[model samples]
Target: MPQTSQGSQAGEGADPAPAGRPPEHPPRWSWWLVGIVIPLVGIAVTVLTVPSQSPNRPPAPPASSSPATTRPPASPPPLPVGLFRLTNADSLMCLSPPPGNSTPAAGLVQGDCDARPEQFWRLRREETGTGVVYSVRNQHTGLCLSVDAAHKENDVTVTQYLCGDENGLFPDQFWSFRYDTLRHAWRLVSRNSGKCVALPAGSGDGEQALQEDCDGGTWTLWRT
Candidate 1:
């Protein structure tokens, strides 16, 4: 009714602010959550994602090696030492190298068991790579028993000569002993001839020792 003011009518449309209050903005607790709590949560996540540190350890040892192998040495033959007599099983005579003939190429013989030094032979065992063999040396004549060179037949002559050495090892000079356990005797076999030293049937004393076939019974067997 009276003169109404336009400015007062415009202010009347809006609500009035409360008296004695500060201007509205974000909450203090929200600023604390953004600056401190949220940053601490991010740091915990980063620490969980990162790989962990490991302690120092020693390296493993190398694999073990195998032990070395050792081979056994060759053994010696079972023959006697010193001088001995070879008594023929068939004739009961002693083998000798031509009594009083100490020279080479003297034929061997069998005679009465007079217990003479010439009848006694010394067996010298040689340890060769092939096998064990013996060189029959006369105690009196100092000669070694042998067979005629390269003769492989029966009744081949067995002789005595100078003992061969490593320089000239005559194969005939080497002899091998074959033992017959049942008869308790031995057979003297020649290396070159491969025959046994045998006595002929019904032969008497002073008969020549001959190389013969390894058969026809006990004529080849000898006893020491």
Candidate 2:
């Protein structure tokens, strides 16, 4: 039997999709490509946004650097205790009691440099408000060098006496050393008079040592 013309046209016009269902989706590979491309774009953006340190940049210094330490200078040694001969610079003589006189209150004088007990003096130290002073003690008579209180003149005679005061009330027995750089020696300065032990001009043997103005000259300088 030959089909009708209307039936043939209806059969040829059948629906490509089902009546109540959605159309077929795209290929799975296309979805995978979209997912990969989106993540790659996000990673590129993150890398560009963050900052990076330069390869040649120097490292930062410490927050608080410690300062360098320095050391103080050393102090000089103290003078030693011993018996010594005091020689006058001007007259070039040794200081001792008057020749043939070893008694107390005998004046000190310049004499020939010899190995006499009268010429040897034991230097004893005494700390005072002024400074470190010395008591010039005669080894022979066991007396201390002192200034004559009776003489108030510029040039006062220096004598030897007992080595004690009631309470250091008298400073005549205390003497300090003043350094003379030019002469390279020490000047014997009296603590009581603030004067210097010196020899007179054109001093000769047997000349007495007196307290005079501190001229800082060869006359006032003495060597130990």
Q: Say which candidate scores most in lDDT.
A: 1
Q: Write the per-residue lDDT of candidate 1 for residues 55-83, one digit (tens) a residue.
A: 87888898779777886543434677887
Q: Enumerate residue pairs that collide in model 2.
A: none
User: Can you give the TM-score per candidate against the true fold?
Assistant: 0.62, 0.61
Number of the top TM-score candidate:
1
Report how far off residue 5 is in candidate 1 (Å).
99
Q: What is candidate 2's lDDT per residue for 1-224, written digit by digit as tens?
A: 97689867877866657678976899999999999999999999999998986789778887876777886544333443788888888778998998668787788999889988889888887877677888888888888888887353567888888787677525688888877655666788887778888889769899988888988568888888
User: Which residue pairs in model 1 clash with each other?
Assistant: none
Total backbone collisions for each predicted model: 0, 0
